[model samples]
Target: MENLERTLSTWIVRYRWWFLILMPLLILVLAKGLDLRFNGDYRVFFKKDNPQLQAFNRLEDTYTQTKNVIFLLVPEEGHVFRRETLVTVERLTELAWQIPYSLRVDSLSNFQHTEAEGDNIIIRNLVQDAPGLSDAQIARIRDIALAEPLLVGKSIPKDGAATIVNVTVQLPGIDETGEVTEVATAARALADEIRAHSHLSVHLSGMVMMNASFSEAALGDMDFLIRVSAGAMLVVLVFFLGSFGAFGTLLVIAMSALAGMGVGGYLGLPFTPPSASAPLIIMTMAIADSVHILATFYQELDSGAGAKCRREAMQESLRINLQPLFLTTLTTIIGFLSLNFSDVPPFGDLGNFVSVGVAISFLLSITFLPALMILLPARLPRFQFEIHMMTHLGNWVVRHRRRLLWSTASLMVLLTAFVPRNELNDVYVHYLDESFAFRQDTDLLDKYLGGLYYIDYSLDSGKTDGIHDPVFLHKIEVFANWLRQQPEVNHVNIITDTFKRLNRIMHENDPNQYRLPERRDLAAQYLLLYEMSLPYGLDLNNLINVNKSATRVTVGIQVLSTREVLALEERIHQWLSDHEPALVTEGSSPAIMFSHIGEQNIRSMLGAMTLALVLISLLLIGALQSLRIGLASMLPNLIPAGMAFGIWGILVGEVGLALSVVTSMTLGIVVDDTVHFLSKYLRARREQGMPSESAVRHAFSHVGMALVITSVVLISGFAILSLSAFYPNSGMGLMTAMILTLALLADFLFLPPLLMKIDKH
Candidate 1:
């Protein structure tokens, strides 16, 4: 392997001209396919066969698709019943139909109100001629709406201080990416128009707005965050290398990123928030290879090798770093490829893209980087301060080997103790920070009106039109009543509400008659009469299927954690088992789906991580040719992840979809420091026949500065990602940075001392 490394380095310099030209040309050709498109749909988070997603799909097929945009109107006067506010709502409701792909629009002014007059049932818009309504009429409207079950918590709050105009858009599903943005844009424009002339404050929230925010966040990160991370890498590069020409490192990384994105494009993957950070991540990971080679090259040059020996210096640098770089790249690719085990498809895309980029970076670092360095030679000033600091650190660790090892081990144990504190939880709306309009509007909506988080159940009755049976209606009413009693539940929109309203209207408007009809025939007759009287777009299709075998019961919930969401789901299922077994069905909604996926992802990644650890350990044992040292390397490699989670548990105490993948994702990265340190330590012991103490010293002096430089670059790169408004990306960034930092410390502090004690005999 040493001879092979020497020969490979010789050839890389001998054909430097060819390597520099041919490699970049090949990369650019591959990068030509790097046409990335953005998709922000919530459904993108789940696989096609994901159970919760399948349930949501079935629910949509049975009833109206839940894709909607809600415009919340908060009047300056603090009441929605005022004439001007009503007019603005009425106008917005009318114009909302103009939004692309709009299937229906529901608002205070367009609420279908049913009443009885002399044995005749009258159904009309609740707030008719809003601009001409008298104060008495507006007061009546408020009184009736506040009393209504269907509209109160959903469209209008109990206090009637705010209202939401909901536009239900039936996207063709053929071009949902474009259609979603179109509807969102139109909705925003309409809201802006309303705010321009009315005292009402308009805010938009719903699935459509959330979807649009996903696209906006991805595009924003692609535009801004990548540049920020690159600039950070640049500063670190210049500060360490002490030369601007060290920028050739950035070019190698950039090409690697471009090639990675190109692979994603070639595979026809969409850029989601998780996957959008691929470029920055590829660049960051690729930097380690370049920094290792460059550090060695600079060190060789500072040994008084003249400019004429620059090629020899680079050749020697490549020869030393080749094996470590290859090992690190292999492990990183393994770690990221493990993401394919994730329940979320975007994460899989991220993993694949990055793995490919890391591979390309290895190829470039060995070939293109070496070739480029010879062509444009960099003259780095001596990093005496950095060198001396590493030397001092090594000597100190050897002096207090026993004490330092114990302390670090103790610290690792203490941090790992907190790991169990992290609970699996996801609140989708909170996935985006308040910097997003959707999050801000949704937060306000949760505060004043009710929850955007909901659990949808498609209650099946086992026969056609069975939903009209008095038994079925009674069961639904019981279930809805039970949900309403739950503290986490804010409102329940069951078909029973419409039935009771119609029944009371049929009984001459008597409040005492507001109950389900006793007989199935009577319930059927009442449902038919109501359906016949309702206007277009205000029919029962959203709640009832054509055959009426099942009905959708949408239970509005508070902004609860994923744990609370799952708990409510369990309670609902348990209640069905106890009281209404035949009506049992899996709850389905974006909130519920998101809740399940986070836990599922964690489990999947655990299996993948176990496999990766085994593969990496075996490879390390083979490469280092020492079974004892190989097994010893696992301790430092594994401790960083546990410690990172422990730190997260102490600070946040919650882990979700993004956080779930952190362990597996950081596994490969943290190993880089371990491999470099252990490789050098073992070399000193075997080839140079150094003592344990001397071996530790040699490891630190040889690879210690390089490890620090690379870790700092990687940490800063991810730290910049923590500033993203998208919380999943931000949390992953924050946690990954923490893990990398811990990895560096473990390698520098813990690994050295442990090796000394173990190898002393």
Candidate 2:
């Protein structure tokens, strides 16, 4: 193995100039990233065949599409009844209908209010006259709005301080982001105009804003996060590799990121927000290969080998580090490949992108890096202090083997116990933090208007026109009333509410008659009257289908985590089973889909991570050619992630969809340091027949500084993830960085002591 590596390095040195120029030109050819696309829609997280997505689509097909652009208007007086507020709302309401791809617009000024007028049914806008409305008229409008089922808590809050202009848009098949941007751009301009002209604070939010947030955060990461990560990495490299080595390392990482992203573009996979972390992740991994090679080369040169020893140093460095690098890269690729097992496509994309980056990094590390080192002489002296400190660390591990082994093992076990504390809870709206306008605006809406979270329930009556049956309406009314009573549920919109209103209107506007009609015929006639009075696009089609067999109900709730949502869903099922057995159909929506996936992803990742564990273990065992040493290596490789989750359970206390995949993601990466450390120790023991203490010393003497430097570089790279605006990327990054740091500790403080105790060197 050493002879082959020596030959390759010597050959690379012979043609160093040609290879260096050629490799970079090849990298440059692959560095064009403008062709890469990005998708920000929340739906991109789910696959086409995902049951929750299909159910949501079916629900959309039955009712109007729920994707909307909402403009929340907050009046200073804490009441939406004022004439000036109504005027602003009226103006916005009129403009909302004209938004590109808008299918319907609902607001307080355009609510199809119903009342009785001496044997005549009156249906008209609640606040059409705006400033011209008399005080008595405005008072009546407020009263009716507060009492209205569809308007209250949807357009006008039941508490009456804020109102929303809800515009439902049906976008074209292609360029969905373009359509969302158009609506958002127009809405923002319009809101700014309204705010400046009327002195009212208008906040824009909704499905569109959330979708746009994904794209905005991803683009921001690509534009800024990658650069920040590179700058941080250059600092780390300089601290470890010094100026000349750091420059070459940074250039290789830049090429790797560009080439990896370019490969993604070639594969036709767009970078969603979650996947946008790939460039930063790739940059970090790219440094690992370069650091080990260059650091070792510098050591060989500084050990009195001198300028003439460049080829020999490169040869020895490559010969020693090749197996570990290859193994680490392979495991990382496998770990990332496990992302394909995820329910979310973005994670899959992320896994593929980073996997490719890791692969390219390995190739460059072996070829381009060594060639660059030979071509560009790093005239700086070797960093002898790091080597001396690592020798002391090795000696200390042997001296305190018993205490180090027992203490670290016990502490890790204690940390692992906290892993169960984190629950699977995802809130899609909070996926982007306050660093984004969407989050700030969403928080404002949730605080003031009590909007956002929703669940769509499709209730089937089992027979044609059965929706008009008094029994069905009564059951729906009971269910809606039950939901409204729950603290989490703010509003429930049922066709039955409209039916009850129309029935009351038909019966001389008597409050006593504001209940489900006694007969099916009466309920059917009231619906007929209401449907006849509705205008185009504001018709009952959104609520009831043409067959009148099934009705769509929308339940509005506060922003709750998936754990809370799952609990609520279970309660719903229990209530439906006890009260109305046939109404036990499943609910669907973007919120529901994400809520369900947070649980499902954990289950799916369990299998994939286990598979990865087995496969990687086999690879390690085979690579080292020893059952005992390879099996022993598992403790160091696996303990860090387990310990990290336990600590995360303490620090963060809760995780979302990211928890399921973090194990595998960090497994491949964290194992690299262990492989580098262990492979060197095993090589020393098996080949040289060194005593346990000498073998441990030899291992540290070979790769200790590389292990620490690369881990620091990797840690810095992933630590950048903690700064992400997107929650999943942030969580994954923080978790990975924590595990990588812990892996360094485990490898440094724990593994060596265990080796000494086991081998009795």
Which one is best on lDDT? 1
> Model 1 over residues 1-761: C-alpha lDDT tens digits?
99999999998889999988999899988898887777889899999999999889988987998899999999787788899988998899899989998888899899999987776778899998899999999999989999999998889888888999999989998878899989999999998999999998899998999999988998898889988988888888888875533577888889999999998898897788889889989999999998888888888887664653889998999888889899999999999999999999999999999998999999998888888887774667576777888888999999998898999999999999999999998888998898888898999999877658888888989999998789889988988998999998888888999889988988988899899988888788888877888887888889989998988889998999999989989999999999988887899998899888888898899899999999999989999887888888889989998999998899989888898898888889998999998888878998899999998888888788999989998999899888888888999999999999988989988998888877885
User: How does model 2 score by TM-score?
Assistant: 0.97
Question: What lDDT tens digits, residue by residue, belong to model 2 across residues 1-761?
Answer: 66776676677667777777788887777777438766788888898999999999998888788888989888877687888999999999988877888899988898998888876778898888697999999989888888787887777766898888888889885998887788788878888889998857888899987887788888887778887887888778787777888888888898888888888888888778888888888888898889888877888878755764677778778877787888989999999999999988889998998898889888888888888777675776467787888898888888888899999999999999999988777888888988788798899899865558888899999999989998888889999999989998877888888887888888888899888899988888777777888887788878887799999988888899888888888899899999899899887878789998877788888888899989899999999887877788889989898899899899888888876799988888888888988888988888899988888888887789888888887888788878888888888888888998999999988989888877664
Clashes of each: 0, 0
- lDDT of model 1, residue 121: 73
Error of 1 at 378 (Å): 2.4
Model 2 poorest ten-residue lDDT run: 29-38
Reference-based TM-score of each model = 0.98, 0.97
